[model samples]
Target: MDLRHFRYFVAVAEALSFARAARNLNMSQPPLSKRIADLETELGVRLFDRTSKKVNLTTAGEAFLPKARDAVRAFDAALRTARLLSPSHSRRLRIALPAETSRNVLSDIVSRLQQERVQVHLVEASTADQQDLLTAGEIDIGVIRLPVEKQGLWASASLGQPLGVVMAAEHPLATVAKLRLCDLDPYTLVIFQRRFAPGLYDEVLDLCRAGGYVPHRILHATRMTKALLRTESAVAIVAERLAKRSGEAGSKEFIWKPLEGSPLHWWSSVICRANECVGLTRVAVDVILASLQQHEGWVPMPRSVRAQSEDIRPIEQRVDSVNAH
Candidate 1:
């Protein structure tokens, strides 16, 4: 009927002696005997055959023994699992990001968290999809690009490396120290589809329009490397870190260059729900912002746009500290 009753029943069932079961349970023989008598009465079955010298289990007691053991085991297992999954027990953060962004920054964040014994579940999706997942509660925080205008969402200052262009090594533009969007007008271009990278893709299109040429025969690919390898005539623009990882040879042949215009950079920020802000998110954001500051030549996002995300509130007034790092 109760957990204590089950425990008492198991002890008596195993030992086959009221005196031994009471001693094991640290209770007196009289109380233990009475409790077992009450349980048998409640169940409407006899549990033991007792004589002055010996005690043995009745058929009803034997039948209930395995069931009682199973109940105790199941309850204990459920308790253990709940403890393991508790936020305090795990101390891990569940984060989501676009694959490209994760490739650039997630590893470093994970390594830092590991030192603190915090585990991180890093899930990868397209930039837009990651945002949707973040909103849907599928992930706690997301690494996403700038100019994200969703309400109830907040973003930290740019976390890690900025985005750069990837072009084939043999391309004439690769010869330049740095290339601009204007410089790529003569060549066809390959880029991530608008669905995956609406903000960055639109920026590229706008820059091309300013240069007076539309991107010709633009090929859409889900993955950046696929877009690069599939297009021989078109130069693929990709994140700088991805360019470095893709290599110059093998399936994809490409080169990388920094866009020439002043402050020509694509950026990523850590995003989370404004209302859900908590200690873990703050700790993670601090670690990432610190890493960003340590790297040379990294700049914070502009004040106007940065002010929109709740994540910047704490760090906004501390600009000197951010830049000094």
Candidate 2:
């Protein structure tokens, strides 16, 4: 079996559906099925046990999956090493960070790295994509939203964002010194897309509901501007930094206050392959952390790190959040 077989096998193994794997690989289901069949025939063992309703890995498949993933990652690392040897890219470092990271903080990270003769191959990806890219060796280090499974990776201390309400200065609850989740009951909620950080997204809504926050509706927006819109009738759930920025931008049109119980929060961390956090990779993480703390006003921890719900929230909640704002 060649690299193509490994790639196809890994895709199918991760997705667990021939149809979904084919779509992800930009191929067809029939050909994908044939490739797996060819792989199994060559190995004299079956990898997946397929049923009409679901797909599963055989014992042999389960045993081989890690090795397969390692091979793919090794190949990718080799290519990156080869490219890094070139004079122009000798100090180039590949890293991906979350979308919500401040532009000024990003600029500071880039500037600091440049002073060390390191060039950043920065990719701004969604929270879901950071870990996948890091695991696949597509990036040397990744800054991802926290509370993710960190089984085989090196992670930094999580930096938490104090959660708050951002609303037009004229909104009914804007003048409150501190707000509770229940205070947002009457207005729609403006929040980020769930695909960015599934756990965090669900936890926000679940915690809100559990704390007696029953919004008239929920709205999700991929863009900051849209999420910040309709503030007269919406209460945007945001980090303190974002709230402050909005408040500054609107020329006193917006106000932000911490939650009364301070239960809501967001966290992020800098991560790299457990064994690969050295030299420039280490520098990148340091610069990011320092920049975030000093330039972006993010805290090392939230005022209150309440226990988060282990279970994901219902799908209908996500659907409503996505359908509006």
Candidate 3:
């Protein structure tokens, strides 16, 4: 059986529904069903037991599922290795990043790599979804928030930044030295949607709950800009970097204060599928780690480093100012 057959088989086994598998594979149900039938015929075993109500894997199918998955994974790994070793092949490194990560950080990394003549492509996505893509070999590396719990992935926590509570400049809390969880219970709270920032969202809820009150009102937003704009009569807890940028953009409407007694921090890192490092991937990882180390403990880089790198300068400057305060 070819890789395509294995792919079809794995899809069917995972979904357990021909229709759903076909939809995911971007093919019609009849053709997908026929491929599965052919696979079973070749193997001399019934992989799936079809029923009027549902489809279920047989014992043989169950036993073969993991093997099938491993086969597909191995083929992908081999293909990647071949491409990596072939000088004639265009070496394109694919990186996935979270949407909340500062554009400046991304731009800086890209700029440095481009200057070094590294061929790369970046995919922006949520941390959780990006991890999945990495696992499936859809991407080579991922720069995402820390605390990811996926198995077979390597992650490093490079640095952490404090989260800040942002409010309209005219809001009473804006004058406070530090904002407490209790202080925000009285106001509506705008938060990142669960899918985009599950860990952060859950942490915020847990912290608020421990303070003896649930947030009075909750508004969900997918994007930071949307969340900030929707903060009518509400307070937003966002990354310090985000708050600073928003404030500078004449959020003359808003002010931000460090959260008091909150363990809220933004952690960033570079992650990849475990043990899958190749030449380009290794170089990319090394560069990212080196950059992080060079800028460590300073909260941001000095003006020289920032000026030397156009993409990263703005973020570095903002981070430096925040740390200076």
Candidate 4:
């Protein structure tokens, strides 16, 4: 059958009532019944058991239901891809990111997309929540923190920066050239909540454990390092990029110093559903990688390689903006 048959079959299977399915499809019962019958005949099996009282899927119907839904979903995604590429249709890419993300990376990617005449709508979400949204198709793609479980999704670490500690400028540890994970054991540590970045959160804790220190007083929140360190003798582990953009760190108020021993690398990744069409999402992923490559610690992939399977044109111009988020 066609896509329409799959759509009709899904609606009927879900509703389990010809009258309800017809009404939901905005068609009459006879035509809807005929369509189901046609689909069953074409498939050489009955898809539903019908009687005067109720309608239910037979054994064969149960087996075919999932396949039919998959067909409809694929068809819908193809239509969405066509609509996205048309000049008449608005080319808006919906991207989700962690609440406390790098300012320069996001600004650079947005500037690049705007030059290509594409609009980006950004949503602030936790890394865990972004994964959920990506799987459900609520967002086009997401920038998530590393150490994430792929769960059969497509993801890669697109950008990385050295992780450091942010603390009050007057704190005793500020005089040191660099601080290690064990150095913060004396003060309360402020870190991102587990819900926001579970992988990163666990990594920080594990590092502390390895350093022979289990942080007893840890504050977990999604606030700026300045605010987090203001109330008490506390420190927050953050990316060097975020520390530089905070401005408070450079002033007399705060100080950011890299970790000693092996440095901790804060990584951000781009993720999308495994089966999603990559026409528009591919462009957004490239913009992220291109913008991040300018950073000191970012790893560059080969120019000839594509992150996604789709073939897309490269953005020719690089743009910069002063915005920070």
TM-score leader:
2
lDDT of 3: 0.67
Evaluate all candidate structures by whole-model CA lDDT and list the values in order.
Answer: 0.64, 0.73, 0.67, 0.70
Q: Which segments of candidate 4 are over 4 A away from where they belong?
A: 1-90, 102-107, 224-228, 295-297, 300-325
In terms of lDDT, model 2 sits at 0.73
Clashes of 3: 2
> 237-258 in candidate 2: lDDT tens per residue?
7777775664533457766777
Error of 3 at 96 (Å): 2.0
- Once fitted onto the true fold, the runs of candidate 2 whose alpha carbons sit more than 4 angstroms away are 18-53, 57-67, 70-90, 168-172, 175-177, 214-217, 224-232, 244-255, 302-325
Judging by lDDT against the true structure, name the best candidate: 2
lDDT of 3 by residue, 132-212 (tens): 687677888887654445667665434556666777676667777866777777787787777664654665577577765
TM-score of 2: 0.75
Clashes of 4: 0
Candidate 3: which stretches are off by over 4 Å?
1-61, 88-91, 170-172, 211-213, 224-232, 247-250, 278-280, 289-325
